[model samples]
Target: MFLLDRPTLGATWGSTSADESRVDGFYLGTYTPDKRQIVLRDSSLVTIPDAWIEHAWSAQLTLLLKDTKRRAEGHYFNIPIPRQPGSESAYFIELADPDEPVMYYTVPAGWQAEFDALPATVTVAVKEKKQGSDSWEDAITIDTIKFSRAF
Candidate 1:
């Protein structure tokens, strides 16, 4: 079983002579076994770090699970961060297997728009860790996906 703490939503604004634009911000904190108290960490990169131009738009904690004896491969799941303003809400998820590895990732979902607006082929960074290995190899170029426009 996995538990998710309340997510946080932040925003950045850009202003010009005629218009103002809002960019969403996402930040995630830690989780606990019980729901009584949620602890916010000071060393969190998303919360303590500051940028002059960019910030987190949305954040969520994802817990991946699989049967160790039956499944040979792992899966990726994207949990959408709630658009709430405070860190009071909590989410819970239960998996069939408890021995599955627990991994934490801080992916900025709000940045998807910038990637979607790119033209044609896009170069992406890939990293992988071999089974039974303790360390992940350095990032390598693997594949590229091309987008088609129907105009």
Candidate 2:
């Protein structure tokens, strides 16, 4: 998941202070095998380059759940890709499905090298850890995305 950088798209959840830049909506994104490359959903397909990793690896988005109490709340979203899929990977040990409205994540710095080593194709396992649970339940397996980086 990635945050769309449009402030006018949603209601303000936090102060508009310059120190706290915020995003509006969350766009479903695909993490291809290409290192630091992410395909984001917007008016059309937008491929963010590795250079963006330096500045946009983390962001704040407003929660837009139907629940009035939680809606419009600010949440921090970060990139925390696993070294590999499966529970053995520390990145897979996260709390819940951040793709959910209650966004929660921690950015792991210095993952560029690991990302660059990823194969040209990979399967991602989608899992969710419900509240009060100690284990993750496999929800589904995302289909693989293959693209040619050959120029």
Candidate 3:
């Protein structure tokens, strides 16, 4: 699950989406525990000699909270998502989507504002398989941070 990173260690996990496919533009991520490349998917753009390990965690948890909150009209905290295989936290939401899913994982407002104020490195770990259908966890894609110019 994204290597089970800790908040205190400096990171958060969550996502949210208003539309049906809220997180479509987000780049899929993974960790590939074998070579530690932190692979990111660019439609199979990576042809280098590197292996990918399934990363089932995320850089933030704002996506989950937002979606569930909106669905319940801001009544999601009370709900509890079951634990999915290869996941670090066990919120009420299920780790359902990995292919162009619509979800926004955001950091706290203040902290996020500060973090966003400067250049940052974003790590994205997506589950290779959905827990709903796949009885076995097979997340073999982890896309690490890359540089993108707005110009």
Which candidate should be chosen as best, given lDDT against the real structure?
2
Model 2 / residue 105 / CA error / Å: 7.5
Q: Give the 10-residue window scoring lowest on summed lDDT in candidate 2.
A: 48-57
Which residue pairs in candidate 1 collide?
Answer: 24-57, 25-56, 25-57, 25-58, 26-56, 26-57, 26-58
2 against 3, candidate with superior TM-score: 2
Model 3 segments more than 4 A misplaced: 1-116, 130-132, 135-142, 149-151
RMSD of each: 22.8, 16.3, 16.9
Q: What is each predicted model's overall lDDT from 0 to 1?
A: 0.23, 0.29, 0.25
Flag regions of model 1 displaced more than 4 Å: 1-120, 132-134, 137-139
Instruction: Encode model 2's per-residue lDDT on 27-122: one tens digit a residue.
Output: 213233343333221122222221111112222343762322122433222233433333332223222224333322333321221122222322
Off by over 4 Å in 2: 1-118, 130-134, 137-151
Q: What's model 3's TM-score?
A: 0.19
Cα TM-score of candidate 1: 0.21
Q: List model 3 lDDT by residue over 16-102, tens digit each.
A: 321211343221222122222322232322222211111121333353433221111111110111133454321121122334223
- How many Å off is the CA of 117 in candidate 2? 4.6
lDDT of 3 at 116: 17
